[model samples]
Target: MKRNIAVVWGGYSSEIVVSAKSMAGICSFLDEEKYNIYKIRITKEKWTVEVGGYVYTVDKNDFSYICPISDQRIYFDFAYIIIHGTPGEDGRLQGYFDMLGIPYSTCGMMASALTMNKFICNNFLKNFGIRVADSLYLNKDTKYNLRGIEEKLKFPLFVKPNTGGSSFATTKVKAVDQLQQAIDAAFGETPDVIIESFISGREVTCGCYKTKDKEVVFPITEVVTPNEFFDYEAKYEGQVEEITPARISGEMTDEIQRLTRKVYDLVGAKGLIRVDFIISDNQPFLLEVNTVPGMTQTSFIPQQIAAAGLDIKEVLTEIIENEFNAI
Candidate 1:
């Protein structure tokens, strides 16, 4: 029997549009003979599935799509979460699915919760000898010591939402005067903000995933942005150059890939994860880990997948089959 696959996309954050595009790209390659694909658009307004221009509401309790014509409750056998932020990426949806005994295609509740917080994950990796930049953690209501923060971390700082992705509200502060405005802007996205000292170096990212058999690491991609950094514009727009199998030395590539796997194991992440790094003075600094990385025309995962001499269909199939067979 062909298993029903629910491609859960959209979210309660700015990354929802990107998530929709990702779902479309992945769905385009999904083999229809072996599996039945259902596009579940999740948002603050409604949880629905549209078929042939007809919208059917999904039963949140049992995770079933209600058929408008016959009123049949179609339950999904597997859920492929492509949402990049909030409920999908931050563990809320994962936890809900957990309660229903439904398996998903991303990290579990705890791992998602831990990794979505940049301060916690980076500091945790720091303990494992993975170097991360010195940063100040701040909450919306917490009193921030600006003088103390400035004294500890030098100028040319990066202020970003600790729990947000796609560089939604991230800012690069070149001077001390621009700190407050950046913090305020970051707070608009999430409740917490991380202010880290800038590390000038070659920006590169490597993606890794695991199966029941072994872990798979893709070739590293070098990110050369004409902007201030690899911000939203550089990532989604055509403001940056992403070179796969980066121009870095073989030794550095091996080290970052090793570190990337270690971080994945450390966070207990499932599915594919992209780890960003900054190699400054020949030392690789861990920037951040993307649990649900992009899959659009300009995304790095597809580029890395091709550079590694692998097919997107097989790679995505391996991911889906691994989860489906387990159940």
Candidate 2:
């Protein structure tokens, strides 16, 4: 019997467009013969499932959809989560799926929550002796010591939303004068933000995933952006050149892969994830882990996957099989 697979996309986050694109790519590659796929679009306004040019409202009680024409109810056997932020990336959706006993792609609840918070995740990695940028955390209501931040971190720092990704509301301040405005912008995105001392180095990222049979790491990619940093435009637009097999040495690649696997295990990450890093003074500093990495043609994960001599069909199959076996 063919299993029903729901590719859940869209969330109450700025990355909804990216999530929608990710699901579109994923849906195309999943072997249609083996599984019946449906695109479940979720938003703050509504969660609906489209089938045969008709849309049906999702029954949140059981995550099922009833066809209006036939009045038939359909339930998914598995869920492929692609929502990039909030509710999805932050573990709320995972928790809901857990209660419904539906296996979804990506990490479990606790792991998702831990990794969504930048300050907490970076500090957590420090326990394993992983190098990360020095940062300060600020709440929306607190009085931040701007002078202290300037004194300790110096100029050329970053202000970013504490829990958001895609560099949404992220600002790079090269001088003290730009600090306040950046903070306000970051706070506008989220109530909490992290201010970090800039780590000057080559920006590279490694994609990895662990399955029941084995663990796999894709080739590292070097990010060279024409902008000030790998911000929103650089990531989604033509403002960046992402070089795969990252013009680095064998030693560097091995080290990065080792760290990648180690962090994957440390965070108990499942499915595919991309870990960003900055190599300075010949030492790699952990930037962030994307549990739900992008799947678009221009995204880094797809580039890394292709560079590894593997296609998305095989890669996603392995991940889905692993999740199926676990359930």
Candidate 3:
């Protein structure tokens, strides 16, 4: 029997366009014979499902995907959420799906919510012996004091939104004068922000997945962006070069993979995830873990999957199957 799989994308996030692109990639790669795929677009006002190459707009109040032929409603057997940020990655939509009793690919509500906040997530992992960069959390309600920051951390610090992705509001400030401006920009994007000591090191990431009884980690990917940092343009505009199986020592590679799996288990994550890190002073520091990673043509997960000599579609199918059987 062919199960109905709903590939959900496009949410109220700054990464909405990126999410749509990822949804396209996922729909194209999903197996056609084993499952009946439905491309569902989640907008602010309505939820529409594409079936038989035609789009049918459904009410957002009701969770049913209306069948045009039978005039009956069909619920999704499983949902593959490709939305990258905001409601999708921040556990809002995941909680809604949980209430609906639907199985979706990705971590549960708590893990997703915790990992979405960079400050809280990194601090939580520190108890498990994870090395994160030295950072100070601040919010709009807090007092702005540059002298304290200057005393605690050196120049060339990174200012970023604590809850956003795609490097949307990330800036590197070299001097004290630029600190306030950077914070303003970051705060414009999110209420909470963090300022961290910038480390001059190679940026690398690793992808991981878990099945019913086993976990598999993919090769590390080294990211080289043309800009000062891996910001929005570098991430989405092809202003960067990504190398799979990062050109690093064998020992470093093994250590990163080990840390990746450890953090995955630490956060109690399931399905697919991408762990970002930086190698500084011959040591790896945990940056963040993405629960809903992008699946675009240039996305890191697909590249790593290709490097591992595995079909992307097959891997996604296995992930969905695992989610189905886990229930």
Candidate 4:
């Protein structure tokens, strides 16, 4: 019997565009003969499934819907969450799935919540001896002291929404005069903003996932962008060069892979996750952990999987089956 799988995508954030691309990539990679795939589109307006030019509404009560053609109630056995932002990325959707006793393809509620907020996640990891850049966290209600901020962190700081992704409303401030404007821009995305001192070095990212039987860590990818940083344009607009099996020493690559595994275990993460880092003076500094990393054909995870000489369909099968095996 084929299990019904709901590939959930879209969110209430700007990353929804990226999510659409990931949705396409995931649907293409999934094994059609083994499982029944349903494309669930989530938006601020509705949760629906469109099939053969017909649309059916999802029953949020059970995460299901009535098949338009067969007039039969279809319930999803598993949910492949590809939504890049809340309520999918921030644990809200995880809580809903938990209530329905449905398995998903991302981190659980606690890990998702912790990682969505970059400020808290990085600080929490810092206590575990993960090297991170100095940063300050601020909320909309908090009174920020510009002079104190400048005194603590040097120039060329990065200002970004503490709770979102896809580099939306993220800015690089090279001077104290540009700091306020950057923070304001970030605030437009979320109520909380994070200001971190820049790390001048090579930017690299690694992807990993572990099952009960084995751990799989992918090849590291070096990101070289002529832009100020790896912003939205560089990530999705083909403005960046991504080199897999990064041009680094063998020892450094091994250490990075080791740290990637450690971080995955630390956060109790499930499914595919990516960790970004910056190497400065031969030391790797943790940037942020992506629990619901992008799965687009051009995204980092797929690229890393290819470099590892692994099949995407096999990887997806392993992830989906791992959840069932655990139960």
Model number with the top lDDT: 4
lDDT value for model 2: 0.91
Q: What TM-score against the true fold does each predicted structure earn?
A: 0.97, 0.98, 0.96, 0.98
* Residue pair clashes in candidate 1: none
Backbone clashes in candidate 1 total 0
Q: Give the poorly placed runs of model 4, Cα more than 4 Å off.
A: none
* Residue pairs that clash (backbone atoms under 3 angstroms), model 3: none
lDDT of 3 at 267: 93
Instruction: Please give the CA lDDT of all the candidate structures.
Output: 0.90, 0.91, 0.89, 0.93
Question: Which runs of model 3 end up more than 4 angstroms from their true locations?
Answer: 52-54, 59-62
Ordering by TM-score:
4, 2, 1, 3
Worst 10 residues of 2 by lDDT: 139-148
- Candidate 1, residue 76: CA error in Å? 0.7
**Which residues of candidate 2, in runs, are more than 4 Å off?**
none
Residue-level lDDT of model 3, residues 1-327, one tens digit each, is 899888999887678888988998898889999998888888787788988788888555546667779998887788899988778888998898898888999899999999999999999999999999899999978886898897787898999999988888799999999999899998988899989998889999999998977778999999998799998888888899999989999999999999999999999898899999999999999989999998987799999999999999899899999888878
lDDT of 1 by residue, 1-327 (tens): 998889999999888978988998878767788889999999999999877788788888799976767877799988889999899988899999999989888999999988899999999989989999999899967897777778899888899999999989999997778889999999999999999999999999999999998789999999998898988888877899989989999999999999999999999999988999999999999999889888875689989999999988888889989987777
Question: Comparing 2 and 3 by TM-score, which wins?
Answer: 2
Backbone clash numbers for all candidates listed: 0, 0, 0, 0
